[model samples]
Target chain A: MTTLHVIAHSPFGDQRLASCLRLLGADDGLLLCGDATYALKAGSEPLQMLQAANLGPRLFALAEDLQARALDGTQVIAVDYPAFVELSLHYDKVNSWL
Target chain B: MKFAIAVFSPAHAPSSRRALRFAEAVLASGHDIARLFFYQDGVHSASANIVAPQDELDVAAQWRTFITEHSLDAVVCIAAALRRGVLDDTEANRYQRPAVNLPAPWELSGLGQLHEAAQLADRLVCFGGD
Candidate 1:
């Protein structure tokens, strides 16, 4: 089953994003929200890491959080609350890295 | 699809509020919630004694209202609840605690119940931890 890895912590805090990427299945997706959106900050090491992963369209970020943190210029699929509900159902499971 | 939502955040945390909103959206979208498992600090949401400041939102109250409105099956992890001092009458008696902070509609069960819900649900979503 495909898993939607929801990460709400900052990538600088721990290895959650790295570990999620390491275990991510071929079809798995990553959704960044809350402090995790900080990873999208321009020129941040976390952004480089995400860019290197080549996630393409499989990566997502909460639009409200992105706007709150002023995280723009990234190629992430921004999801609203309704879209978040839809994405969770579209996937087989959601594993939150809390 | 059915969802088994596990909350690991405290009542005052942002994640707790987010989880509640997600649960509401899930039902509004025609999805079913198999269980609401409160673990770790999340057990505080089941505490009836919680009182938020007049200006701040009371997430615990909101959660209770939501659960009651839907007549949903909400479970607070026994171990976590005990650790956090959230107790029902049965547990208050069992442990000789001073008060019974957990009330009707919110049941206290073991982690196995969460696992069972996850087994039966199409999705297991968790919120908050640190």
Candidate 2:
């Protein structure tokens, strides 16, 4: 199944995000929201780790969350709530990392 | 539809209660729950030592009774449970603990169980901490 893992916590602070990363299957994807938007900042270690994982087009970040945190310049695609809903429909399962 | 629920918060948290309600609603609507995985602080729901006040609801007991009545596959992550002092009989004995708090219906398992649930279920919704 194509799974979409929604991470709503900060990368450095919460251990669940790391657990989510470790559980990612080959066809699985990730969606960053809430405090997780901080992880999308360019040059951040978490972003590097995501890149190293080779998630490619599967990685996404919520535009509203990033804007709320005043974050910009992310390699990951920035999607709105509607897009988020659409992504959830596209995937068979969604695992929120909180 | 087969649904899998994951709870990331403890029994004291609102998210845990919300997850339970959601699960009940799903089952009432004729859906099947493939598994319920409790990770991180959510493992507290499986512990039997919780004592709520007379007025306030006992979330742990609520989960235990509901899971028992439904014969649900409620799994508490072993790593997360051990780290948070939520132990089953096997874990309590292995760690030399005085008592086992995790209830019988709720099993202590690895993260692989969560992955398996995700793959098997049609949808996997998570209620997590803020």
TM-score of model 2 vs. true structure: 0.61
Q: Report the lDDT tens digits of candidate 1 across residue range B57-125.
A: 999999999999999999999999998899999999998989999998899999999999999898888
Per-residue C-alpha lDDT of model 1 across residues A1-98, encoded as one tens digit per residue: 89899999999999888888889998999999888888898899999898988899889998878998888836899987768888998888788988
Lowest lDDT block of 10, candidate 1 chain B: B121-130
In the range B1-130, model 2's lDDT, one tens digit per residue, is 7888899888877567757876787777677889999998999878899898889888889999889999999999999999999998888899999988986899999999999998998788897754
* DockQ of candidate model 1: 0.63
Local lDDT at B51 for model 1: 88
TM-score of chain B of 1: 0.97
lDDT of all predictions: 0.90, 0.82
lDDT of 1 at B83: 82
Top candidate (TM-score): 1
**Which regions of candidate 1 fall more than 4 Å away from where they truly are?**
none
DockQ of each: 0.63, 0.20
- Off-target runs (Cα >4 Å) in candidate 2 are A1-97
Candidate 1 lDDT score at position A72? 89
